[model samples]
Target: MKNILKVLRAERDWSQAVLGEKLNVSRQTINALEKGRYDPSLPLAFKISRLFERAIEEIFEDDKGEENA
Candidate 1:
């Protein structure tokens, strides 16, 4: 999964810790997400989308070939 989390965080001038605070996750989790080393659960995806005022599709790109097709 590819996500615009880092871009959004940069736009907000938020550190990973601050983003984690807002999302109720750990900094490590935020770091993992930003690094594309982890995929968030569905609920977490929704929460992030809402927080960023974007649709889930806008924040998280489903690059899995089957899903896109």
Candidate 2:
């Protein structure tokens, strides 16, 4: 999955560790998320959405292509 997590964090002047702290995850997890090395679980996605006050769809996109839509 591709996401604007890095952009969002940058907008808020938040470091990876700060974001991880907010999400109750590790800095490495945040790094992976920002780098698209890992996709967030549904629960984690929700947490991220809630934290940013943005819908999940607004933050993350289906990099596999939106052909289904």
Candidate 3:
């Protein structure tokens, strides 16, 4: 997945640690998410959605042309 997490955080002038604190996660987790090295769980996704006041789809996107069997 590709997400606009970094952009959103930047827009708000939030550090990774600040975002992590708001999301109840670690700074490393936020960094991983921003770097696309990890995917968030459903609950975490909802938390992010609520925090940003944006729909999950607006924040996270499924890579196109990828299909599951």
Q: If the candidates were sorted by their lDDT against the true structure, best first, what order would they fall in?
A: 2, 3, 1
- Give the total clashing residue pairs for model 3: 0
lDDT of 2: 0.96
Candidate 3 Cα errors over 4 Å, as ranges: 64-69
lDDT string for model 2 (1-69, tens) is 899999999999999999999999999999999989999999999999999999999999996767776
TM-score of each: 0.92, 0.93, 0.91
| Residue 4's lDDT in candidate 2 | 99
Scored by lDDT, model 1 comes in at: 0.93
Q: Cα RMSD for candidate 3?
A: 2.1
Per-candidate Cα lDDT values, in order, are: 0.93, 0.96, 0.95
Please write out the lDDT profile of model 1 over residues 1-69, one tens digit for every residue.
Answer: 888999999999999999999999999999999888999999999899899999999988788965769
| All models, RMSD in angstroms | 1.5, 1.1, 2.1
TM-score for candidate 1, please give it.
0.92
Candidate 1 scores a C-alpha RMSD against the true structure in Å of 1.5
List candidate 2 stretches off by more than 4 Å: 65-69
Q: Cα miss at 20, model 2 (Å)?
A: 0.3
